[model samples]
Target: MFLRVLGLLICFHVSIVSATELLVEKQAFSIDNFATFNGNVIEEVTVGWESYGELNEEKSNAILITHYFSGTSHAAGKYSPDDPQPGYWDAIIGPGKAIDTNKFFVISSDTLINAGVHDPNVITTGPASINPATGKPYGLNFPVVTIRDFVNVQKALVESLGISKLHAVIGPSMGSMQAIEWATAYPDWVERMVSVIGMAQTDAWTTLALEHWALPIRLDPDWNNGNYYGSTPPLQGLTHSLMLITQQALYPDFINQIQPQHSPLEQAPLNDINASHSAVQWLHVAAAQRATIMDANHILYLVRACQLFLAGHSGSLEEGLSKVKAKSLFLPASSDLLLMPYMARLAHDTLARLGKSTQYAEINGIQGHLDGVYQVQQQAEKIKQFLEN
Candidate 1:
């Protein structure tokens, strides 16, 4: 959910910016009685998706781009010429960019509980969605979904389109976790995989760090045990959660450069105990903006999904990874503390030892985990080469 930090960069760079523009529209897909990992069923499920380029007659040229937390299927192009910017990965996903829409049909979709519930462009089913059975928002009654469940829905969508296999499955952060799961869950269906700032499993330390993202939302009085629907939503709790997430996702160096003194230009915090530092104030503004469009329960559900991540949902990571048939590329950011580079490294090494086809690289940047998405252009050439042969 932390991948949205790209907007904070003074200059966003990609391998190449295509001369021509890409225009796209959002679409929807639905599933019936989608079962959850814990044996519950979501009677009906729907998600938003958009794509670039064309699907070849053989359907062998299709590529799937799973989104990170707080992201959607709008992976490239603008819905209208008036848009402020193209999709998140526009740099490497256009006509002549790394993913190359010219040759491959690229598609991305929103996850089951995407955080962009308030964004007009996104359609997702989460706790806030209506429960057909009860005639009320599902709230906490929504079945707990896993990365595996997310993949299963995507698989159903792909099959509905008459595609037997994916040319590749690419994602960043939580997206990476899904990509890895795709490789293992249906080895024959996925031919290639690209995981940026990803790991094979969520360990104890990392899971605890993620739990902090959920704590604030749960502590809010308005949360009301996740049944706040049709009532006052947990705005304060969501804002604080976003604030904590933003702080944890970025690097100290990058933030220090933006606010070295951590104070307002005209005011000194020392003058009043009630005053908050500039960095804290900045977080307040940023987090408040994000919280307006985000749902507290959705964030809580996503945190649970992430914390429960284990590729293939198997007994062990090695056993799970051993099922992969896809040629894989691991691209962990050099400075990411959220999901350290070593996690990706360990996954890559495990695949190598298992005699699987795999490659590893690092994207260097100051955004820490955010770099996996914002600075991913650094590895565009490598991504292009890997996708080619």
Candidate 2:
């Protein structure tokens, strides 16, 4: 009886290990030296990324997981047993989960502009960081980038892994932007696609929100014209930026769940009250929350890139969207004020008219734009059923 009980326990553990969790891993890839976009030619580039599951013999089962503005490559499950935060989408990507590892392999990559200005743990190469050749941060000198540029880099990464094509490219918010771009930019590279709470073009309201988020950072005296590095860096600037963004990215419904009675700011008192109290207090908490965890410069870079995204920048919206040949799934969030559903509705109609296989579903959740993230379970199940069908 004892031996039988031990055997049963061992079998359960193996099953859990093989079918419940992903063995997430990381790798470095090099991009082509002359990858050009938006009228700029990058000589060479290296992108950092993480992968969940194993690529099959044919590499056709690969699923690309693009991340949002402040997100890293860590998509689902814990990086390590001692890691504090579970994978960003702990509920979704896992063995035997909605995006079942037993059937599909998953890959998520960190963008070039990653966390922090001076943090060594973050392997990011961006405008704010020093140019290895010049011994100076790229600063304002960094060449402007666009959504298409991001897709180009990802393509390089995918090719490096010997993946001739992708089964699906899926992401939430900013990631959704990349996913959409991937479908159009390299139609032959993907078989299917999914985008959550995003649109081909950013609305004016969305651009205004982004501008406001950048305002406080720009107003801070410590900004030092984007040259602050060694000394007291732009803590005030970054903090204010984070605070504004935190407030903007959230819906009243979502915040109400985390802090029922008051805002995250109201919970704490003003530190003896000063002229800079309103900005400092709120921005301080916001900065601290995102500071070490993410790079301010990277956030600004991605957001600025997002503002430049226009589905038809290369041609007419109809012509540009017509480039996509992959079957698509569009999940627009209900109450998303930033990328309004109207735009997504337009995209669906445009694609349908273009003769591409496309489907659009407005997810019914209280998360506003964040329905793409917070409601992943329902979203994942929907996707699972769709993909299976």
Candidate 3:
């Protein structure tokens, strides 16, 4: 049983764990006439998925990795030797690393309305995707997607592979929400869940925080209420949104080192209102580079989906989590300012109080929320131990 459960958590914290490399391919999963929780229907839905290792005959070794809000299906490996970086979790998902692909079949996929639509590697159908009916972008016409919607799509992908149950579902940030949803919505399919930088519910505080991400995009003149598909895309608003996301995702301690702050007497910003600090300029350059490949509407839709998140959409946290049957672990970053650690603890305490098997741990790092990604190795053994026990 321990061996079986160990397969549940095999991919996370990419590129820093070990030097193992696994070549991977991005594949597609498509289903027609899919119905959503809101009674809306997508005539055709397609998403990109990538897998590592081999699936056992019984398919019990399968583990599904849900990507974060800013991530994609390429959980590990380089598409080619010349590619710059491996997938986000390459360090952990390789043949002999913590995920140990040699022992477990690992799958990770892009979600609906993924932020990286313009990136050639990402394949997802969203507002950015053209509608067959109109032969144009869906834009605002796209149905509101919920975290449950993401899980349902994943379930479809899993079933198409002839897998009846998952050894585990693991993810960080938004990925955590999807993992938790999977446990509640299909308790029988998930045996274990590891949520890093995760929360069982988006509280009132979080809902508003998520709204802040959408505010800039909505305020963009080019947005035109999400109607900028064929016209000039809302680059300005998208840039600001990305900037906000980057700042919120990192702690000051880590960010303080990224760019050196110039002295007031040395920089022109002190004398001129038009001039700005180097740090501000640095973030703008970075955000502009990233904005080119991201869609403004997709970011807004993702934010709305996150704002509406309530675990299984069960109306309340208690009712939503009451459906979970998996052994759960919550790992929140101690320095995180966004999605503060207490949210995870609140969920953990609730689960324990309800007699559900659960565990909690804090990852300490200077990167704050990003620690859940770059610093997960700090708790790799703890995760391995949880899977084993």
* Number of the top TM-score candidate: 1
Number of the top lDDT candidate: 1
The C-alpha lDDT values of all candidates are: 0.88, 0.68, 0.83
How do these models rank on lDDT, best leading? 1, 3, 2
Q: For candidate 1, which ten residues in a row score worst on lDDT?
A: 10-19
Q: Which stretches of candidate 2 lie over 4 Å from their true place?
A: 1-20, 32-34, 115-122, 263-286
Which runs of model 3 end up more than 4 angstroms from their true locations? 1-18, 264-266
Q: Name every residue pair that clashes in candidate 1.
A: 1-69
Put down candidate 1 lDDT per residue, 120-147, tens digits, no spaces. Answer: 9989999999999989999998888899
Per-residue lDDT value at 308 in model 2: 79
TM-scores of the candidates in the order shown: 0.96, 0.86, 0.94
Writing each residue's lDDT as its tens digit, candidate 2 over 142-175 gives: 6778778777778777888899899999888788
**Superior by TM-score: candidate 1 or candidate 3:** 1
- Which residue pairs overlap in candidate 2's backbone? 115-295, 116-295
RMSD of each: 2.0, 8.2, 5.2
* Candidate 2: Cα lDDT at 306: 81
